[model samples]
Target: MNSQHAQHSPEILVFDSSDALASAAAQRLAAAIVSAQSDRGVARIALTGGSTGIAALRALRTVGDPIDWGRVEIFWGDDRFLPAGHEDRNDAQADEALLSHVPVDAARVFRMPCDEGEFAGDATAGARAYEETLRSLTPDGKIPELDVHLLGMGPDGHINSLFPGKATLSERERAVVAEFDSPKPPPQRITLTFPVVNAARHVWFLVAGADKAPAVAKAVGRASPADYPAAGAQGRDGTTWFLDKNAAELLR
Candidate 1:
């Protein structure tokens, strides 16, 4: 949250194994939460879904609870526009991973709308309602700048459902959008646009496995956002790529 670490230009932290990566990320996240809350009295974080992301969250539960979960505002970067309790929903996975283990205030956890909610199966309305909810959190009617935006890079250089070659990658104004034809299954999804994601104070890309090596390379290489959406996740304060050995192979 604060620029306390040495400035090493868009840092990359590599770990030996996926479990170790998860542990280190959990510790780093705890530090950020403590630092932000100490400086601002509240910390805002955007959570991500996916194997590695959920693993880190579960690891967060293993660390001593240094964060005042009550004062922390929790949000998701993207979510499947399905029923609230659907197994594939990001919020459900997150809750199962860590949120349910903490004493975080229910009101502070902002989840995207679902098929059964007031928005009811309308992904566009879900996106609009989530954006409005974000705006209401600040006095300026703008999306809140997250202290930490935890994300996972997909095999296709995607971040938060903003897949490669998708129209959402070209968006510059909206803070959030509903995607109707994601390359992955359960096509409908609601995602925070690049404008909101890149505006965060910190962005941590939690990636693992050899399957992501190529995409990681493209994300750090000379590629447009249209071709590698993950490239657009450059945070305002700092951006860190947390990778396991397999994922870091190409870069090495």
Candidate 2:
């Protein structure tokens, strides 16, 4: 493992293998959550979904850290606009990986509104409802002050459901939006907008696999957000990119 501190852009943490990356991230997250709980009564985290993200969650479950799950709040970075329990949804993955095993307050597990029921399978309705929920979390109606916001980078430089060249990348006011026409399947998705994602106290990117190398380079290079959505994500306090050797290969 090699950790490099950067003065300008996000610090890059490179690991020999994806497993090592996930393990290190999980350990750090456990420490962060414990520290936050000591400073404040509660801790909040926005979890991401993907191979690497799930690995980290599982790793977190194994940590010996005395985390009071009951005092923690959980949220997702994004979810597929499918049924609440759909296997493809990020919420579903989260539950299987860590949520179901933890005793977090049910009220604080803020899962995104999925298709069906009152949402009527309308992505737009779910997006609006999520925005309303976010606004209600804090008194000032601004986006919630996220403790840790985890994200996954797509091979094309997308984050959450915000893809490169998508008009949603230009969105400013909305905290959440319905992502339509996504390059990936199950296009309809509910994703946190840039303004909200960038509001986090810390942003962590979990990226693995050789396919992500190009995207990593572009994101850290001169590519615009319009061309690489990942470039738009900036944490208020700090941003860290956790990468496996393959993913960091092209990160010159």
Candidate 3:
């Protein structure tokens, strides 16, 4: 990690179980959105997809009524390049998990393009279009400075679609990029680059499972992002790790 990132090590919050982590994360999210809206009239957040990520959204549905969802702008950290409404798509999972229960403005929800759209099977085009959307929302023609950016770390230490040792890990110019050869299934995907993720005011990582314990330890220890992508995700204001006992077990 760079000196700037090293100066802002992540704050660790361990939970008794995944369920507890989800509930706590949801509460924190609600508070964050409320605080941001109180100060700025709107809140922008990026969502992640995975068991733990979805659990947090579901938990939010129970405690998020205090939030003025209509003024909240939603974006995804990454997305599978499947057709819209595909059960496996992150946006679809998010809609089923939380959006449907909230009164969020449809126009504020920025979903990455799917394979069946005008981009049509072109992950690169989809990524570029999403980048344009983000740029349009910011004065500098870069990515939007999200209020809160959520992420789920893979057992392999990847975050978003950025895998360890991949060329995408070195990306500094683009705010978004296409991942055509992800180690995980349904290879084609689009994801926010580290620059965009780091542009957020707060980055919250929700992780669970014994399989992730080692990676969590490495990430917390400030391992090189090229070797542990999660280590690269630091927020401008703060970075936090919300982990279950299983995930934090190896932390020193």
The best candidate by lDDT is 3
lDDT of 2 at 11: 87
State the lDDT at 61 in candidate 2.
93
From the highest lDDT down, the ranking of the candidates is: 3, 1, 2
lDDT by residue (tens digit), candidate 1, 196-240: 887788999999999999988877763677888887677777999
Question: How would you encode candidate 2's per-residue C-alpha lDDT over 65-108 as one tens digit per residue?
Answer: 99999999888889999987999999899889998888878999
lDDT of 3 by residue, 1-252 (tens): 121444486799999999999999999999999999999999999999999999999999998449999999999999999999999999999999999999999999999999995899799999999999988986877577899999999998999999999999988888889999999999999999988888789999999999999999999998999999998888988999999999999998
For candidate 1, the TM-score is: 0.95
If candidate 2 were superposed on the true structure by all CA atoms, what would the RMSD be?
4.1
How do all models score by TM-score? 0.95, 0.95, 0.97
lDDT of 3 at 55: 96
What C-alpha lDDT does candidate 1 achieve relative to the native structure?
A: 0.89
Candidate 3: residue 126 Cα off by (Å): 0.5
Could you say which candidate leads in TM-score?
Answer: 3
